[model samples]
Target: MTQAPGDVVLIGGGHTHIQVMTAFGRRPEPGLRLVLISDQTHAPYSGMLPGHLAGLYRRDEMLIDLAALAEATGTTLILARATGLDLARRQVLCDGRAPVDYHLASIDVGIIPDLSGIAGADRDGLAVKPIGSFLARCDAILGAAVDEGRLRDVAVVGNGAAGVELAFALAARLRARAQASPPARITLIGSGPVVATLNAGVRRHIHRALDRHGIARRDGVRIVAVEAGAVVTATNERIAADTVLISTRARPPRWLGETGLELSQDGSVATAPTLLAMGREDVFAVGDCATILEHSREKAGVFAVRQGPVLARNIRRRWRGEELERHRPQTAYLVILMTGDGRAIAGRGAWLAAEGRLVWWLKDWIDRRFMARFQTAI
Candidate 1:
């Protein structure tokens, strides 16, 4: 079936896609129509996720109601999973619905946490991506830990910034639950230095914070398997844990293998600097699901947030037969890690690193400001 001549379909309700919706809402195109296809009704704001886990923010406060936003913007919202795309027909294929046609499409569905290679993880480990489910799982585990009435050991697998903050958040939650009871033991297990890519000072600050919180650090050990009540290391040493959390980096969604678009080494859609899928102008990809073919950057939320404006402008420009704008991602952006204790670790550029309650306030201000951009008018 043919859609309107100017129908632009957004494939996910991610950060960049939300910007597109807001742009169209604030400015109208006489004949253009917008449709957003989202598998979930709520979009989690990345900056506030850790805070949510740490009980700093309520769940609803950290989630954007995509349905409401779509209604406010006059965009059709399809609550269905996009299985794949029929690029030849300019249509999106869904799980149980007829393909929807589009003149242009953008993808911002986030990456899946790769756990296929880790033995026993499927049954015993909890993944930290698809943040909503992870939070729920953590709650269940927290309940179980409370009933146990003893000091429980927790293992966080992965040493990146995410894994680190998750460890801290879990520690705070468990500590609060224990009160005068046995204090929970938390161990961060990884194969390398925590936030290995950051500067020496930043890593040191994180280490100091971990020490301050009494969280044990286990480095140079890869978690080979997650079993019931314990995690087995590469050398077969077992670390006892009541809960195991997997916070590994991106693993391309299995369905991406079917998409004809070019993909990067890590299996994300290969997008040009302009946020367009390489060799396919009709399709634009951003956020964690896309990889910039040139000037490679980490799949961090900063890039997606920065790309939103350019993506909106480029789409409008192309529709109006104007020149397109290329998105230039900053080489160095600020990094803030919440310690779950009213304090935060922050790093800017390459040389500076600091930790304090002031840093947490700064981070909170920036996060609230970003949310306000969409929340205030909607």
Candidate 2:
């Protein structure tokens, strides 16, 4: 069945785009049709990612079923990767189909792990950027560990939230496995201080969590190369590991750079306060792929989730010839870090850390509730 031309084409199933889908589902604009284009049928929510890595949540639990979402939202779901964009033509180019024509387009394709310059990164280490690929590789690694009855060593490169969460999750999982046998030695290497963007209290809390898990932390260590069983640092230090997870320097999808859209120095799509492309009014962008001026926050799922309503409103307004509303992100939001067990740390700014199973429970409840909102109603 052919869709009578859509008003807006959303590129990618990232958090922000998903929110747009949900909002439009609840209250759709009759004239402004929405189409969602994504490579994955199921897009995982980033908040529950650490839990998935630690084997706490099943794949289904962590992922949002985009097919069902599209069905409920009355939006077209095209399961294909966006290869390019014709800004002047106001169309989206896909890998294996006719170029999709649209009056407006929003890109939330997310970021790709930057590993081109790191020697052997593309060849040896498994990049943890595309969540779907990372999940598959993680399964393989876990399966091998379970079969061999031991995992030698695992290295997680990067000091940001993703890296820290993944490192702790791996450590927790390995420790749990070791309780039954021998544990795998895990090391987290970072080029700068861990959680450098976070407040001091949050940083201290994470450091304590890492120590508690017995996961070794190496700071100010640049990864020069990734080898078969070792990661060489810029200082000529070699750290041995059986598995290497790349988790730093996220770059915008290459296609964005090639599309000739106004881009930030880092290659992110430049957008206005309404999240529309800088030069093209018909084009909008969100998530890690966008560089929104005025309120540039670190690439976190929270920000992406918050942008959904604004994006939805703006998209509809664009079709109706109405002014768009600007999105204002919270100056400070609560950060809850999971320990891969049934515990977590909650803190903001410089303050003592508070720990309890309740925090974990709160996190679980919050994540589950957020995910349930998007679950296909049977």
Candidate 3:
């Protein structure tokens, strides 16, 4: 293999980097080498993750094969965890490998649930991000319940979309498989109204869904600690549970803060609208790891997907000494919430809310199409 004149290193095989790599694969840039450093070779598509838990899709169906993508795109994939960034030296430090150097670099390392502050959560609770680990543990827990022929009490912390969806999905999956014991008891604990970020109509719909499933809901309650067989609230009320799942708000990797790059208050890499790291031209950050300074938005996958083309374009423009383009995110975008059953709710801002099996089918179709792109030669 020939060493190209310039090296473009992408850390983390996140959603944004997927599009970047796919685009470069279709149109290779001569004299430039592409390298991807990722801890996991397979990237899970988040949209289908809940459905996968609900038994609607298989594990492989929801994952992007990074190794295959790398081979197709002519990118060298390094299977190592990124420890830190050497901005002054233009290198990526890894745990067990030599430092990777890059003339141009971009980071799309996604976030994880911040459970460090929660007492005993690290030891007793299962986090839902880094999807693979959660999936594996989910299987084992559910498998144990099935094999033991006993009902299990499952608790989910956080009332956000991920937490609510996961709670319902877990209930649906457990109910589908009949055990000799009684049905599993699922409880949703939240610091505020569950799905509060969504529109009122959507929230009402989710509440109704929870009621129909006979799932317990605890709102406006703060969990002070997680115990072996239960979670203790601030008021010392103990909520009994056999398994605890965490789907709290996103938090950037701690290493990102250690890089000394200008970071947002939440510890995300602060970047200009062009997706370049703030005050730096050679480095860029995207996805959950980045905070678009000009038009800050919540860490969402939709925004990251939208940033992909602009990021790739800006990277090329910088390389060619051309003007960079700014990426302006939409003020409001379509929001789709899937019920564990064959139903989904679709809303665009607060103006519209529709729900039915057709909506779920539409979501399923959209998810499958997005996944098929990576599964094939593209």
Candidate 4:
């Protein structure tokens, strides 16, 4: 069969892009060639990352082999980082490689931690991003501590889901360690209540969980600077810590703004309901890299997963000269967040929330099922 003459390029092996890869691999578009460009061979599943951090899952369990997925989908995998775009020429310039030309392109490159402005943060603190690297560093840190019988104080900065989860995971891992050293002091620092986006009831339960784990809470404290062995707060309070993990506000890569795509104030590509970059139907963006301008949903993995099929269908539709479908992002979705141990918190909005080991079991089951799909080709 003569393959599609033009190329459908996918940048970044994030959740949504992986889904598209799988779908296209199963029933590929007649003539369109599929290509995937990513710097990492395996894409970490964020849903199970907290569990991995907490030692509940092995590293391989939470990672999707992007290389294998690309092979299964008959995609040309390019192991290179996309540096920028030439919209006029419709080419994606990559580092150390020739530009990738495409009739249509979709970007799902997730955001990175914004530690540029913070003093000493880039040097002293570790940002919980580029998960692979962070995990490697964490393994080294914990492994050395376990071998040396040292207890290190850990401070997690960020009140969001990522921050709260990391704090809990660190506490859980430290508590479970066989070392007899005094339980590692874990502190969670946030400008507001932890997991503030969740229901108030859920937030309170999380606070109680912190207490149960003996993790200190410093709410309403803005970290102004990170110094050696401590973090300085805006209130002139210096919190002592040997390790700092940053899970604060995620910022889009600087190159996204250079793509000539419409971007929100925070630097994510602005896209229409069709998931197409505004003013350009040939270009699309999804996952944490793109902002749904109309819905303005929170940057969560659930929406990204939900957007996968829509993005896939729309990309094909655009090639077929058909009207693209609008993606209706759900306003309210269930939240079952890991609490760093074998338990979880399940809740909806402010009115609905609960905690228990059962929730953890449910979360575990769901996460495992999600990962199981990628174990084989679609």
Candidate 5:
């Protein structure tokens, strides 16, 4: 069998890229080679993240194995970080390997937590955007709590969905552990209301969950700096905390800025209707790493996964010199949030919240079904 030249080179094993891999696996395009380059072998599904943190699912169960996915899809898997891109040359520059020339490239490298401007946060606080790094630190924190006989005060600095979910998960996990030992104090601080982007009903449901867990919510509070034993807010309010969890707004990886591609003010790669990088048809991007021009929304994995089929089709179309397809995202999506217990809240648009263990079970069933698609095939 002759190895044809590559057609599409995808950087990052994000949800969209994984979907592309699955599509190619099930129905491969002849003469169009697919290649996937990713830093992590297993890509964690963001939707199941809160559940995983709350001990509802194991790490392995929540991850999509990129190596296995590539194998199943008959795609070349390159284990490396994409450092930069040469738009003119149409090549992806990786950390340690030779440049991969591509007919078309799609970036789904996801965003990183912005801690550069926050004082002492880079060194003192735990930035929990990159799941791989956070998991390692979580193990260490859990171990220390068990051995030291000290009830560490954990302070979460973001009040968004990610932060709220994380706070709930941490509070539940800590309280469970504390039932057998000393209790750890959990505080959730934010400059704005937690889950402010969500609808009113969803916000209320999340607040109720936080209240039920005894997770302190400090709204209108901003962290000015992070220190060893405390976090100083913007108003010079020093809060005593042993561990700080940073889940603030996500920023694109710095490497994207150096790629010479058109970028939004926030540093996300700019993309066209077809998800291709602006002014560069050969390049494409999606997931949290991209800022789509036609329609903009929050950086959610649901959109990334939804964009996968369109991206895959567009890539194939570009390879075949066919017309590209435009992706139209739905105005609203059903948000199912886990309460870190056996219950969940379901909200759609301005609809009232429906809370019950049955909702959690339904959400679990849906998430598990979605995850099963990427598992290693027998």
Candidate 6:
């Protein structure tokens, strides 16, 4: 193999980077080399994760194989965790291997759940990010419950879409596993109204779905701590549970603070509309690890998926020393809430809401199509 004149390093195999690598694979730049650094071999498609947990989809069905993608694209793949960056020298610091140098770089590392606000949560509760660890933890919980002949109680902390869908998905999974033993008792613990970020009509549908699943809902009460076998509330109320799942607010990785890149108040890399790092022309960032300075949005998978093409185009422009394009995200998009039982809730804007099996089928169709691209592409 020969070394190209310039090196373009992608720090993580995130949603946005997938598109960037695929584009460069199709249209090679003779003077540049492409490289990818990732901790996991398979990047899970988030949209199908809930279904996978509910036993509706297989583990492989939701995964994007980084090794295969790299091979197909003729990109070098490094299996290592990124620690920080040396901005002046243009190097990426890794955990075990030597530093990787780059003429141009991009970071797309995702966030983690911030459990500092709730005492003991960081120690006692399981986080649902990093995808791989969460799946293993779910398996451990289910296996232990089976060995004990029954699952006593399971509590999910946070009332957002992930938490809500997780509560229902776990309920369905556990109920099926409880064969001859007593039924599983699942509870949803929230600091505010269920799915508070969604519209009221969508919230109504989720409420109905919760009752139909026999999962108890405890809302409007702040959970202050995760005890040895229970969760304590701000008002000193305690709820017993055999297992605790944390799906709270997203927090940017702490290592980003050491990179010397200008970051937003939330600790994510501060980038312009073109996704270039502020005050730097050689660096860029996208997905959950970046905060678009001009038009900020919540840390959602949809925004990351949408950023894929824009980040791809801008990188090509920068490589050619041409003007970059701006990415203006839409104000609103359709929201799908999976019920874990062949039904889904679809909402857009502030007033419209619909729920039915057809909606679930629509969601399934869309997710499958997005995944099919990885198979047919680099």
TM-score of each: 0.96, 0.95, 0.97, 0.97, 0.96, 0.96
Model 2: colliding residue pairs: none
Q: Please report, in order, the local distance difference test score of every candidate based on alpha carbons.
A: 0.86, 0.84, 0.87, 0.87, 0.85, 0.88
lDDT comparison, 5 vs 6, better candidate: 6
The C-alpha stretches of model 2 lying farther than 4 A from their native spots are: 1-6, 179-181, 350-352
Instruction: For candidate 3, give the lDDT of residue 3.
Output: 38
Show model 3 residue runs off by greater than 4 Å. Answer: 1-4
* Predicted candidate 3 versus true structure: per-residue lDDT over 1-378, tens digit per residue: 233488899999988998888888998887887899998889999989999999989899999999999999999999999999999999999999999998999999899888865799888888898787888888997788677875478889988888888987888888888663677789999999987877888888888889988889999988878988899898999999888888886688899988889999899999999999999989999999999889998777789888888988887788877899999899788777788889987777876778889999999998898888889996
Model 2, residue 341: distance off in Å is: 1.8
Sort the candidates on lDDT, descending order.
Answer: 6, 4, 3, 1, 5, 2
Q: Cα deviation in Å at residue 33, candidate 4?
A: 1.3
The residue pairs that clash in candidate 4, if any, are 4-31, 4-32
The residue-by-residue lDDT of candidate 4 on 39-154, one tens digit each, is: 98998999988899888999999999998988988989999999988999999989999999989999999999898656899888888887888888878876786677664678
Give candidate 6's whole-model lDDT.
0.88
lDDT of 4 at 150: 65
Per-candidate alpha-carbon RMSD to the true structure: 1.9, 2.6, 2.0, 1.8, 2.2, 2.1
**Model 3 poorest ten-residue lDDT run:** 1-10
lDDT of 5 by residue, 84-188 (tens): 998778889999899998877899989998886579998889898798888888779765865686656889999887888888788767766665255777899
> Residue by residue across 216-288, what tens digits does model 6's lDDT show?
9999978989988899999999999768898888877899999999999999999999999999898999999
| Clash pairs for candidate 1 | none
Query: Model 5 segments beyond 4 Å from truth?
Result: 1-5
Query: Candidate 1, 295: how far from true, in Å?
Result: 1.4
* lDDT by residue for model 2 (1-378), tens: 123445679899998888888888888776678898898999988899899878789889999999999999988998888999987787899999989988888899998889976899988898887889888888887768666865678899998888898998887777656643557778999999998877787787788888988899999999989998899988888899878998898888888988988898789988888888887778899988898776777777888888888988888777777888987778677788888978887866556457669989999999999899899563
Q: Where does candidate 6 stray beyond 4 Å? A: 1-4
lDDT of 1 by residue, 1-378 (tens): 133368889998889999999999989666778999998988889889888888899888888888888988889999899999888999999998989898889988888888876899978998988887877787877777677674478889998999999988887777666562767788999899889978889999999999998999998888889998899988999999878889886676767768799999998999888788999878999889898878788878898898898999988877776778877788899999999999999987789899999999999999988887777665
